[model samples]
Target: MTRVHDMGGRFGDGAVVPEADGIPQLGDWQARALALTLAAGALGQWNIDVSRHARERLSPADYGRFSYFEKWIAALADLLVETGVLTEEDLSGQEGDAPHPLADRVLKAEAVAAVLARGGPSERPSNVASRFEVGQAVRTLRPAANRLVDGGHTRLPAYAAGARGRIVRKHGSHVLPDSNAHRLGEAPEPLYAVAFPASELWADPEAPGDEVVLDLWQSYLEPA
Candidate 1:
């Protein structure tokens, strides 16, 4: 889907800003949202990729306006209902019979601090070797599909789609997020670091150091 989120090569305002002032990374509500998301994941309901797609599926307007954690919260809220774990009433603080999502393994407040410190892992073993190798020329896949109607997640960004690039490095085979997000199991695939020229994506001057290197899966690329 072509959206503002894919700002790979666009020329920005080029506004210079000061260094970090040490403000909190997340507000109170966002902190709560993160906790809920992590707690839900502990239950084995949905994977990180699914939650990512849920955020990406949001309307463009909402997506552009939402902060990073806001998107996370929205996605978590949606997934809860999608998995039949909770209903609108349950979230609204109304009395309902919806089973506690974490009834089997409740997330204690004290444990929340520890859980967030150690992030969730999603590495799957691969039985097959990677199709493409480092230094190989490749072209990205360009599909006319949107998550809202098409129903899936993709790591391929719009600007990089259909563009040719060279595989700078191979990150080895890992769980294919597209399939994992859909609950189709890991479906391991190769991941590569592809370097695309700035001119190719933005039609701008290809400075000697100006380039976009993105991590893309094997499914998104083909031999050029």
Candidate 2:
């Protein structure tokens, strides 16, 4: 199902204005939000896909109301509560200054730099072989109806759906977010970088020669 988070290529949405110097002007709370999220993720309660899906699960009103990091903090709170790491009382500041139950796995400050450098790699051994090869013409799977899609969480964007493209590069197998987010097995699939003509994605002639390339999973594409 199309949720509030899937706002790609939609019209009337304001342009994404970048910072003048292209540097992120993050506030203290926003910085804390990122650190808290990474720290909580270190506890191994859930995967990155689950974290993303959790943010998507926020109420439509909340999703729209919250800022970028605000959404992260809000979703992190819900996830912590759901995983029994924190309680409503804890969130409300009613709990005492007791040592955390999972203190053993607490991400230490000393390891932050190392942990950040050694990021969580999702590449895995594929159970199946690659289906499409590099430089193969393909088309993104169109939604059954005019509606975007019915699946809960997906990497496929609504605008890219039903568009014809060519596989420009092969990314090998990786964790499929659609399945992993919903507690399904990794179900690794071959991924490829598909390049589509600008005209196929947009009717205007502003940048017709430009191409939009997306890293798409094998299941999301077919022979065009």
Candidate 3:
């Protein structure tokens, strides 16, 4: 089996480009069927009401990949439930109440398939400002009382918080769930990846003359 790393190169946009031959083989009909099934699962998991909505949001290429790896989807669903990202009730009609470990694993695979159908990790919406053009000055929002624990706060990384930066590019809009709690589902918000000079982020006497780009949500900014 070819390692995933051996399969593709990372594009400038952070997307992977699998080698042409690296793509697995599947008939058109089979691929379409898998896409349809995975779309259905996404609707159930995300509480999305319309099947068309799920399909419209997903990529045909990603859908085919999901079809090719059905087992992986089931495993992911199990993991999500085990980790409390989902509930047993979510898997109620899907599978039997077997041992938690086994049931969870099965559900994880199913849920993963749904996520793949929904465009995988990269496709989620964000909330960051696009109002600023390139080279525009912007101020980072101050950290709120409850900071994000999974790393640092959302929209504003600690180094950039309270710091000023230039908007290097516009990454468009995406869903901005409360990063601190990730509750309230998700809401559409503009997204931007601002560039901050390394010297600016760190008070280093001697550091590489490189800049760090942060994917900031719109809510994390005020006028500089």
Please write out the lDDT profile of model 1 over residues 37-56, one tens digit for every residue.
77877776777888777887
Candidate 1 Cα misplacement greater than 4 A, ranges: 10-16, 21-25, 97-101, 110-118, 144-151, 206-208
lDDT of 2 by residue, 1-224 (tens): 47778787667877778667766777899998998899989998988888998999899999999998999999999999988999999999898888987989989999889889999888899987888877889999876121122456788887788999999999889988888887777878898999999888887736768998999888888899
Candidate 2 residue runs with Cα over 4 Å from true position: 96-99, 144-151
Question: Which candidate gets the maximum TM-score versus the true structure?
Answer: 2
| Model 3 spans > 4 angstroms off | 1-118, 121-129, 144-155, 179-181
Which model scores highest in lDDT?
2
Per residue, candidate 3 scores C-alpha lDDT tens digits across 56-80 of 2234454445543453344345545
Better of 1 and 2 by lDDT: 2
Q: Candidate 2, clashing residue pairs? A: 1-150, 1-151
Give lDDT: candidate 2, residue 42.
92
Model 1 superposed RMSD (Cα): 3.1
Clashes of 2: 2
True-structure Cα RMSD, model 3: 11.8
User: How high is the lDDT of residue 1 in model 2?
Assistant: 46
| Per-model CA lDDT versus the true structure | 0.77, 0.85, 0.53
What TM-score, computed on C-alpha atoms, does each candidate reach? Answer: 0.83, 0.90, 0.46
Minimum summed lDDT over a 10-residue window in model 1 is located at 143-152
